[model samples]
Target: MKRREAIKNLMLFTGGTILFSAGLLAGCNSPAGRTFISKQDIYFLDEIGETIIPTTARCGGAKAAKIGLYMKMMVNKCITNEERLIFLEGLKKIEDAAIEKYRVEFLSMNSDQKKELFLNIQLEAEKYKKDNKSKPSAPVHYFQLLKDLIVKGYFTSEIGATEARRYEAIPTRYIGCINYKKGDRVWATS
Candidate 1:
């Protein structure tokens, strides 16, 4: 190769390498690289999920279904950045509310206390929605978001589908008419 051509190619290669290296270094410091969900946060979420779907004699609950981890994944990947921020802030708010109301942390509260707390929060969310006249397109209250995530994660989990609800791997025969019972668990799939 000609000397001039060789120098030009070397410059191009060096420039490309420098750009790639800078990008890699920048990524290490990016917001995405930080750990937003700590272990404590995950445990808190698990407790919240368990409260939402307590384990019954017949089936496992949200914690057993790993609903907290599912919520984390969904919040990180599926939701918008604003929604994620709201959810993270809501966690702290829940703790604060618990402390103010019961003089104890949310995780330290008993099942009945937790249920009452959740019910109160649900009422507050409803009142907020009603007062604000929020449109359907607008974002919902963080508690609503959390409740939705918990329910979605739990019902979609393997334990929920198979144990909490009736699960039939294959329907051997289709019965058009079947007896209905008032307290029957709904079928997850037909």
Candidate 2:
């Protein structure tokens, strides 16, 4: 459990490997009474994920990679029951926050509104971390989780691999330091 917790925190901060959670591979073998992410949640999650990694001049973002579907698999399979609930509650929190801010649901928000909402959640998470600085095992806010998963899922997805980052199956000889370009995509060695 400590290892899993550590991995979760690590991903939350640094965005670890793709959605290969043990639960994902474990199939429907989670302990009985476990609640899974519902279909309705996926739509909001996609919106959030897209907000986290919006398409830009470079390439399409998490939505192009279908990150919400990947997140669903990760949460249902790999995430612990506790974290799973946190994730779902996080969705509800997003909706509630949206309503409070715009008098509309999160899904009803325009792109700019969504971005602003995400920024507010990020601020809240930072405040949460500061207030719980002494607690080593303090859990992160769900927005943090959403951001982490967006990065992981995006970078590992097909579009992320071939477009967002440079991916070559077979490489020529390693050319040691070429002149670096400012807008160059990072190499996907994995």
Candidate 3:
């Protein structure tokens, strides 16, 4: 090929490649048929997390740690598309189940009712997990995913580390062997 023709061909190919990549990126950013995580959804997830890890006299629970936002971030970024669908669907199912059972939305229900609903859903998730155990490619139970996210987010948050668990901001020395106590809280650093 002539030198001028070769340079022109290379430039054309590079331009086309850049345009294709830009198009793909733009398509990804466009939320076509995508279900957005609304403020209500965040509140719902917060309620679920609070039910899973209720506030106690010692410290604040998952809700105080803002676990709903954490779950949303993880679902959007860390999980696969299929898992995200399942998680969102599970939220709807929980809402539906509440309405079916009590004729009331989950947020309106009392704490005891919330706890009961969570237990029932947890049982259902366990059953589903058992039924799908034989399938090698089966997805994880949505409740399990929710639970994991809540625990992880809560424990790692500042409130959880300092209030729920004993946190040492600066340790002078390591205790290789410490005396054991029954009701002592675990160290966050440990």
Residues 18-124 of candidate 2: C-alpha lDDT, one tens digit per residue = 44454464444434323677677777778888888888777887888888899999988887766776776787788899999999988889999998888888999
TM-score of every prediction relative to native: 0.77, 0.77, 0.78
Candidate 1: residue pairs that collide = none
lDDT of 1 by residue, 8-124 (tens): 999999999999997687456435543255555778899999999999998899999988789878886898766776787788789999999999999999999999998999999
All-Cα superposition RMSD per candidate: 6.3, 12.5, 6.2
lDDT of candidate 1?
Answer: 0.84
**How would you encode candidate 3's per-residue C-alpha lDDT over 1-190 as one tens digit per residue?**
9999999999999999999986676456424534445566888888999998888998999899999898888887888777777777778878898999989998999999988988898898899989998997999888887888888899999988999888999998989998879998888963
- What is the TM-score of candidate 1? 0.77
Candidate 2 residue pairs in clash (backbone atoms < 3 Å): none
Query: Could you tell me which 10 consecutive residues in candidate 2 have the lowest summed lDDT?
Result: 25-34
The candidate, 1 or 2, that scores higher on TM-score is 2
Candidate 1 C-alpha RMSD relative to the actual structure: 6.3
Q: Give the TM-score of candidate 2.
A: 0.77
User: Model 3 Cα RMSD, Å?
Assistant: 6.2
Using TM-score, rank the candidates from best to worst.
3, 2, 1
Runs of candidate 1 exceeding 4 Å displacement: 1-35, 134-137, 173-176
Q: Given candidate 3, what's the lDDT at residue 123?
A: 93
